[model samples]
Target chain A: MKKLINKPENFVDEMIEGIILAHPDMVRTPGEDKRIMVRADAPRKDRVGIVTGGGSGHLPLFKGYVGAGLCSAVAIGNVFSSPSSDQIFQATKAVDGGAGVLYLYGNYGGDVFNFDLAADLAELEDIETLTVLGRDDVASQPKERSADRRGVAGIIFAYKAAGAAAERGDSLKEVAAAAEDIIENTATMGIGLSPTILPTTGKASFDLPDGEMEIGIGIHGEPGIHRGALETADEVAERLMRPLVEDLGLSSGDRIAVLVNGMGATPLEELYVLYRKVHRIAEELGLTVEKRYVGEYATSLEMAGASLSLLKLDDERLALLNAPASSPFFREG
Target chain B: MKKLINKPENFVDEMIEGIILAHPDMVRTPGEDKRIMVRADAPRKDRVGIVTGGGSGHLPLFKGYVGAGLCSAVAIGNVFSSPSSDQIFQATKAVDGGAGVLYLYGNYGGDVFNFDLAADLAELEDIETLTVLGRDDVASQPKERSADRRGVAGIIFAYKAAGAAAERGDSLKEVAAAAEDIIENTATMGIGLSPTILPTTGKASFDLPDGEMEIGIGIHGEPGIHRGALETADEVAERLMRPLVEDLGLSSGDRIAVLVNGMGATPLEELYVLYRKVHRIAEELGLTVEKRYVGEYATSLEMAGASLSLLKLDDERLALLNAPASSPFFREG
Candidate 1:
């Protein structure tokens, strides 16, 4: 593998160390283990705590969101692997204020299992905790089976909405309700042009032949709906958006926030190209785009792909999404 | 090459269209030609307009920086190619805010030549213009002849400092001096682990065998000083930093702003690993890091490598660096 790493086994530890060092004022580890990253000024008195966790490769997701007005703490695992329950419990304990703590993360099986165990552990400590799973990938399942779909870039929107609500002194139940609303309204799908290399094995996690594309692949190389010859940017955008728009039941005069997210290796220029097509489609469908973000929000490890996420917005969600946020990887002005 | 693009020839134009569409509130095109992108609030009365431009492919560089307290306008070019004099002239005319305009860009030959021609064109139109070239790549030249070095990631520092100065209502000469000071004090170098594929040609810009690396590679696949077997992140960091520290004459009590920038395909997880080593090295050298940015600030198209930039800071420069700035791709809180 031609990666700039010292040793594959130490990648997670070293990366966490680097993150803490780079953003000393933004993030910190609760214990010496360095697996549980908490906001530098976390545990705000009398406020609902927002905690999230998952694998490591998808940056600016679990860890990057741990900051003021966003996630209060994050449990980081190995690349494409779930964090242990102990780590999640530690993160929950570190960020719990008197109100309670909310656990927000994707719908991966390992992550779901671990986070549930952590919630149980938190209860033993007399801390009330709630769990909200994000499963917005339209291609992963049919509309009737939306709960079976995987979470992709749409989780960022959930984080933004829920974090904002929590920052406004919402109760743990209120924050969980807000997060569930975002998860229900948001939809995302992506096309993978290349596979990401596994750092430990120095090999591709999955195989994608040159000149072909995989539509709706999961963040960790999960099977998508189909594999076909590469298509034009307009065609790719249409294919990715058709399912999402239909899944969300978007209609004329619908207000929404759009995210054109890059999956690691895709360039921002290309992401913009995809965004141009997405915006045009939204306009044609008479959807009012209230806010737009086009860049790498969540990613695989150098995987060449792009995901389109649309959050059908209500007044409350829109206001929360626009709230101020700052982190090492994400900042809003 | 597996990229999410429609047609190779349409890559630059499509990307520009996407940028304008995604950031309608932040940027716009001046005329029918989409090569010149100006801030939506351009031509502010009595403010010295700051303009920068370069080839495409490096997203968030010339185009992404055009916003409040950053750049006033940007002239874009084809991938890895400098903009023509006519395009630069048009941008210069569009952003001249009655005081004057400052042309800031890297020291590449084609850019220097075209920008000089644009300045001449602006002179005929009675728009006073000043030029400040950024040459901060320590690996590209010897310290005795630093002016001959190529511009790289350090150019972003020059933009941040000078843009803040211009936004603060500094005179044209004052902005030029501030930009020149940043260029003189900053130093950068990069290491490439893999080659970038050009969209138009659909081929790798250069070649590298598996398990090998190149130190001090240029953004456009230019040759570096050394090529050998791949090294660990610590070793790579040391090699990349040795020349920059020596060239800058950094000593025990210097305060600097550090940027650990990814060259497209490198993961943020790996960037933090590199940053961990870089922070340790800076501490060992007794340099105080006043500000740190770790992300893909400047990039080649999906090139798997990274660069380190250090800008020696004083009270004046430090204030400018910390000043509030907002753009599509960059935001400071």
Candidate 2:
């Protein structure tokens, strides 16, 4: 349980306080609870309010993306626990303008349920709201059951595209449609080499023997498709990319964006190694990689792993992806 | 040792290849060895060439900082080891425009010797070069002997300030002086909660028992001042900041830039917690924080720890610090 924390119970509160203090110009918490962080210049009239929320631990995901040209607000929760519907409603109300709000988040059951409840609550307040769930984890479900799959790193692309659209003064419906389009085209799969330690328990979330890896493990330590001996960087990248390419039906003529994301503990150097192989594989398959992002985008708490995500691109999506954007955790040309 | 690497010997080369591939537009390897990575738009005429290099494990350090308005080139070395003088010389030759080159790196014996040799080699080719060593780790030496201290995260400030100076067409002497100014005004200290396992050796670099921490631990596992039970985040920050303040002679009404850097495995969430306390302490000391950066600026492989760096800023240094800069790892407004 060696961590640079004072009390595990106060981790979330302290983390939020730290974020607000460090990035006063970028993010703010309207209420005293510090559970919902909104952009400093929120409630921009005529622009679709984009909101995303989820459990803590995966930093720069829900909170780090709250800035100009990104999500307008974020509802924060405990580690691996969904935020209460009240928190989500508060975030929606804080960022909602005349154009309405769009709730964008992963397809986790708890999140889906809570967000739905929040949307109902917002509607009662005369606020128009819509939802676009991200289900891009190929290993979580079969292609025919893709809607059942979990959302992983692919959600970043959704945030970028939909946020860009919203920043351009798109309607809530247009933002939701753009987000859904990205969700439909994106696919992600991860291989976990080590388990993350739960901050409260100071213990490993799950057991992973040394020299072994769990392919396709969920961010919350969910069991993967298979557990086996660790392979070379190329082999690991190949295995992770196979399911993603297949799930997206990628081919030689297809153009896409690639993200080699580290799951907390994996080093950027290793992620690049994985990306090198990913690029080679994409080239061999005749897929054109229009943009490549390699780093920790969405991460488990101190989990040693990496996830590969491919977002099949069209002109609109490509333009939005390439659009100028900057957040605490992500930036683009 | 659980790591996502193929072979220890191939780690450095493979990582370099991955960086070059992932950031082709930002970086490129000029020669076949792949040990020297230069900015894609390097050798800008009339601009002083800035170069930094070090071990391989620290991603985004020497390599991630190479870009426009940053270091013009970086020489890659193996994990925690200095690169050969030949490699440094090659990088110098690649990025040297009509103006001279400035060699900026941490203060380490091997690096000092090799960079010196490389500078001599470059001079034979009629290229003028100057060197500025960063020695900002307060824990590594006494105030009277600050120059003997080991350089740590504070070097990033040197890079930011000096790189900005060079990008603005400062002469080599001016850039070196700016870098030296940053090094003289900066102080840093780190605490290690867990040891990082070396990929090549498949073993921890040093032993750190559970529920304990080593204060002032060096990035490469050098012995610290004390080892004891882990303290609360506030207590730890207080201890780390006391020495830094003393070393820098910080006082009321001082303005400074604070960087709360993670040592690889520590989460950004936790870094924020540390930053919250750091901000409070700075306020209590009546010191105004002009700039703040919280995240992994420099890391020790996957070691679980955090380092705090404070750079006393003058108007010129503050402007340089806030200057627009972009690199694969760092970006600014």
lDDT of 2 by residue, B147-233 (tens): 799988889999999889999989999999999999999999999999988888889999999889999999999898989999999
User: Worst 10-residue stretch by lDDT in candidate 2 chain A?
Assistant: A324-333
Report DockQ per prediction, comma-separated.
0.83, 0.78
lDDT on C-alpha atoms for all candidate structures: 0.90, 0.90
Residue pairs in steric clash, candidate 2? none
For A1-333, candidate 1 gives per-residue lDDT tens digits of 878899899998999999999989888888887989999988888899988989999986778888877899999799988999999999998998889999899999999999999999999999999989899998888899998888888999889888888988888899999999999999999889999999899899999999999999988888899899999999999999988899899999999999999899888888988888999999999999999988889999799998999999999989989998888877764
Candidate 2 — which residues are off by over 4 angstroms? none
Off by over 4 Å in 1: none
lDDT of 1 at A150: 86
Say which candidate scores most in DockQ.
1
Q: A167, model 2: CA deviation in Å? A: 0.8
Residue pairs in collision within model 1: none
